[model samples]
Target: MTMVSNEYGKIITIEQAVEMIDDGCSLMVGGFGGIGSPPSLLQAIIDKGVQQITLICNDTAFPHIGVGPLVAQGRIKKAVVSHIGSNPIAGQLLHEGKMEVEFSPQGILIERIRAGGAGLGGILVDIGVGHEWLAKGKPTVDIDGNRYLLERPLTADISLVYAKKADPFGNLIYDKSARNTNPLVAMAGRITIAEVEEIVPLGELDPEEIVTPGIFVTYIVQSNGVDWKWIWE
Candidate 1:
């Protein structure tokens, strides 16, 4: 389907955005730790009380921040992520066998998202080949007499992304450091829902700055403050 620019950019509250996601969905959340998190949206989702989510992200943050509330509420069933060191709740859940965790290297995670966005089956990376994780009994296959590990595609039913600015065309631009995982996550979903701090007219955004194109985006919502646990604030 072709994504067209709308004259009137539909602006909805954070509550409206969270209601669109249902239970038992594969969700790709854009952020690293708590940096690029869509806090208000996360809170709304926690309020909605949806369960059995398969969350895909770079890292899982702490109990009170980022995806923490969902984990604290026992909403997430599984998570495929790169890092989990910061979130002790996640660790406790993993130990208790309450939540399933699939760990991936950071680079491979990005490649998996890219593959999904491009409609590819999977990605083959040497990073996992002969690694302790794979050697310890994970599946491996030989391709053309070369041993390679398969990193499955990370397609999501819904993608929750935070951006600095979004044009009515659905094109997105994210600020520095905040852009982590956002662009890739946006493409890897069937329905890409973006939360932007600012919404601008179509063509207002520079072509060079457009990280996510309009075709991949399905919805746009405006957001207020982000949720970050400071070590700073």
Candidate 2:
């Protein structure tokens, strides 16, 4: 693994952090209505002008928040999300054929990531048995002479998650309601990148509080705070 550590392990810059992200890759972003987005890192990507991304997120919040800015900028070519009802830009993109939208059920979306992280080839779920938009593959496997629909693995090139604190070794601690889909997404990606408000020394955190271990994390970026309004309150 290509792990970079500074003298104090705190010199990781936004540019250095997001440099690993490449265009035309499948990405999963962790945040609910932009509440936990890594603002500095996301802005860096916007500033860098990367394009042709397939984003997997919970909800495409209104323009300028969550995945909305990326979608509005035309950087994201496709999105697999739970809900796109909150963003007008998303609807416009879909209507204009500027973006491809795949709306998965909220619950199955979580399982898809979790299954990928666990090294499973895929998961069998009953969320979208007859849906058209999100359902494309018809995989049948017989279990005890019964048939079941298969939900394939959703592996991402990169997963961007926001956390309250992370140790230099990459252990993560998400604050309160900030833990959305981040925990599972952290492991589902080939390269998991985390943006946190604080990055501390290793062994400084209680083992019980570590939601994600260093093995699953590839990079750590320091985030001042998310740019969107908190909705979980």
**Candidate 2 has what TM-score?**
0.88
lDDT of each candidate versus the true structure: 0.83, 0.80
List residue ranges in candidate 1 displaced over 4 A. Answer: 1-11, 131-145, 227-233
TM-score of predicted structure 1: 0.89
Cα distance off (Å), candidate 1, residue 30: 0.3
Q: How does residue 214 of candidate 1 score in lDDT? A: 82
- The TM-scores, one per candidate, come to 0.89, 0.88
RMSD (Å) of each candidate, 1 decimal: 3.9, 4.0
Model 2 per-residue lDDT at 53: 94
Report residue 39 deviation for candidate 1 (angstroms): 1.5
lDDT of 1 by residue, 141-161 (tens): 788988877777889999888
Where is model 2 more than 4 Å wrong at Cα?
1-11, 130-135, 144-146, 227-233
Enumerate residue pairs that collide in model 2: none
